[model samples]
Target: MSTYIRQIKKNVWKWKNENGIFSVKKYPTVEQAEKIRLIHKELEYMEKPFILPIIESTQEDFIIQPWYKGDHTVSYRFKEDRKAVHLLLSQIHDTNKLVDWEDSNLFYSFNLISKWQNRKWKMNEISFFIESHIGWEQTKFLLLCGDIALRNMKPFNMEKRTLLHGDVVHHNFLSDSSDYKIIDFDLAVIGPREMENILWMHRVLPEINYDIRLLIHEFPHLEKVVRRYKEAMMYPNELYREWLYAYSLPKERKQKFIEQLIPYTNKALTEWPNLCYTLSKL
Candidate 1:
């Protein structure tokens, strides 16, 4: 009956104070953020001294977390933790072990995620969800953030590895001078790291204004392996470059590039003999 509730129902809810926020995207197509917020609330119901942020309450139409109040952007940032990232990976792997797959994980899959809940379209699947209804390849491999790429690894872990944030990306990790806040676990499937989130950066970093030399110079440890993957395969220059994405190339060229990358895929199976058993099945 409240204005906030009405706006939220229409998928047009905004923060009570949307002063400096530039990009404001609501649930977008329909009422989904509300349902997501609700599920998080239920998961935290009857708990003492909530570990996560205030996710939901009958008092507010939607959940709102503290956001940054600034206009400055970093020109040169340095991350100083390698062990923390590996530790986060271990935590994610452990937590991810507990969850099964759901339909919402696929960005391209349709029918599997279609749902009409309480008279509105809602998405509740994890990033690993498959479009298929059943099976091992369809379900087991559908886990979000399972793909192996190093750029998705965050150099910091502030939530202390206790609370399950489910999704981890640079955007979700916030800091003021020396502290970091993990935000938006609403879409989380109770466990997993940044498979999709990391892929987003890995997929887009090249297209953005990122400095590749700087990226390699500072984040040398990870890029070493990525560059090696791109270089190891004895394929055409164009496709081999596209395969190990320490950066994102144009999608318009993806198909042609994939054609170029196939030989390397074959070569990868050849050179990485230990992985030959697994690659053969693919």
Candidate 2:
């Protein structure tokens, strides 16, 4: 049997052999691995276009599964990919009845407002440094958005709570000819499903040039919920989150990321008001 090994990312490795390709990720603890294993089991029977992972084994702090062979949905600019992601996410949320994750410490209740407040505080803590790099104008704009977003924020309907994928970035959805799969449950939690949808919009809106109308038209199911939370969406959550994350990287890497972010920051600033207006009318 021939085998080849490659490191996919930190703490994750991929191996290909005569049988097939497989992924091995080092979980922080055996308990965490077990939790994820249970989640996979619950989602094992989801419908097509929502291919679930097939766990091969879990031993010690290592959980292994077949390495899904496909490019991430982020690589495609088609509406079909987006639709597939939403469909899969909807299915996952619908399956909430199958698991009682609330009792698990790993899947705690989410507090949107408190989390936003904490993130805002962190941004303020590094404001001076960020301003130096991105200019006072951009820094002030982002902080202002954060403030408004917080003010506009409302508590989620806890009664509608379901399993949230937590991180709905496009890269988490993979597609090949045969299947479209959602991966990476490390950030998964039990929360309002709408929160997950909001995160998804934040990630995809920029890609579509922040066209609120176009976004709603593509996913009409979101129109009502999105309109209800328009005020929160008006805040540039993605920009602030990216900036804060870039701040933690090594100096050179951080500088490079900041440089690339400048154009996006400027564009978002220019479009912010219009997007808010469009959402308001919706």
Candidate 3:
């Protein structure tokens, strides 16, 4: 039987053939393509097998790589896989190799918070979807978190900022047998170590449906810092990025993934503040 790759989403695919499992994704620019190449190199240097090897595509359409055959990105078995996830992250985070990119990520995260007042989309129905579920107060707190993170989250001089995976959600974690590997680098950026950890623990972890208390207990030393960072993450910049990406697509191609987006927003708002309150007392 002839094996074929199936589309997982626009410009993304998963399939297995006679050779092995693989995935392909479109790169918006050559710079992105180069960045992925650089990331793969760094991962190899780290002696980590978590990153999937890139398969060069002869055409200019998409970047191809071996698909992790073990499992897809999911939230279950977090406890069992958490250690491997952290280990892989530690290796990647420890690298000093710099990819060519500016440090506008934090700015971008909170930029909308300040400008939302003047944003034409403030009254747009999409905004209503977010506000209705999260409430104005929760919204205000999130923006506040953005403000604080923008102003206060700084790089540690001891451990210089380095390249980060950018998107470290639970699903990026692939478990092959007993080991775990990470996939996706299109959103990679260079930032402070603390910021990377903060972003993962605050934003990505929650999105993956992790229990905030368990996270706090797992890393008690980082509790205060994590909470502070979580507060600053009231507005996840990634959501805006995703919406912009989707909006740029043809109407027929846009699947209104916002259906999932709003609930995630609500989940963050509903849980974060309560977690903050709990953390404060502890």
Candidate 4:
């Protein structure tokens, strides 16, 4: 173990001489870390590379295998390696990694509400944001995607619950000549396979030129579910607010960002009805 630490950012440190990378996480319990480690070993044995190759960690701190010099942006280039990306995600979702893992995807469900409440405990201000921006009326309709899927679509029709990387934001994916890999598993857990794909569809699709039907063909059972989730995505405002609110900023600056997002969110909402209908016919 390297005692020398080079600070890369807040709470994130790099081992000297490119040994590895480490970060201090705020949640996912010590037990979850252990499970992640177990999954890494399993992936290695199965000839799949779990990018989050955990080197070692305690309750709050964990290390990852060092990444090579390459493009780490999570973007449309993923389309270039679509088969590899789908293989990686499918292998992950299909495997039974651990038992009693928490659900990480926020699909429409009572389970998601429970997880939201738990998350709210940590980010108390999010509750205020939710109340002021996404009130009960919105929350009720938020999971319509989940409801439609569970009611109409069959379950995963697999042996084990799908494990999710949770946060599929593009930056979490790294690319090189060989393939793409995922990082940042602090929010990793078991959940619906569609939920993860849905995130990729919204977060990665619009930025790229690839046809989303490629993803649909890969997970045909999840076609409608994926469409529903995609339709529900409230752009810039809802998405940006969620992403930006986490940063430690001055109160005034944060409020400014929120206010600026209102028009964009309203525009998205205004277009959603027509968009929703279009997606429904798909």
Instruction: Give me the candidate number with maximum lDDT.
Output: 2
| Model 2 agreement with the true structure over 13-61: per-residue lDDT tens digits | 9988898889989988887877677788777755453545656663767
**TM-score of each candidate structure, all chains considered together:** 0.33, 0.93, 0.67, 0.61
Q: How high is the lDDT of residue 224 in model 4?
A: 73
- Model 1, range 17-131, lDDT digits (tens) per residue? 4332221234432335554554345434422312234433443444544335433322113333222233333443343233332323312211101111211111113212222
Candidate 3: tens digits of C-alpha lDDT, residues 155-223: 344335666777767778777666777888777766566656665665445634546667767667667
Clashes of 3: 6
Off by over 4 Å in 1: 1-31, 38-52, 59-61, 67-77, 80-94, 98-172, 184-282
Ranking by lDDT, best first? Answer: 2, 3, 4, 1
State the local distance difference test value for candidate 3: 0.60
> Lowest-lDDT window of 10 residues in candidate 4?
104-113
Q: Candidate 4: which pairs clash?
A: 74-170
RMSD of each: 14.4, 1.9, 5.8, 6.9
Q: Cα miss at 24, model 2 (Å)? A: 0.4
Q: How does each model score on lDDT?
A: 0.33, 0.80, 0.60, 0.52
- TM-score between model 4 and native: 0.61
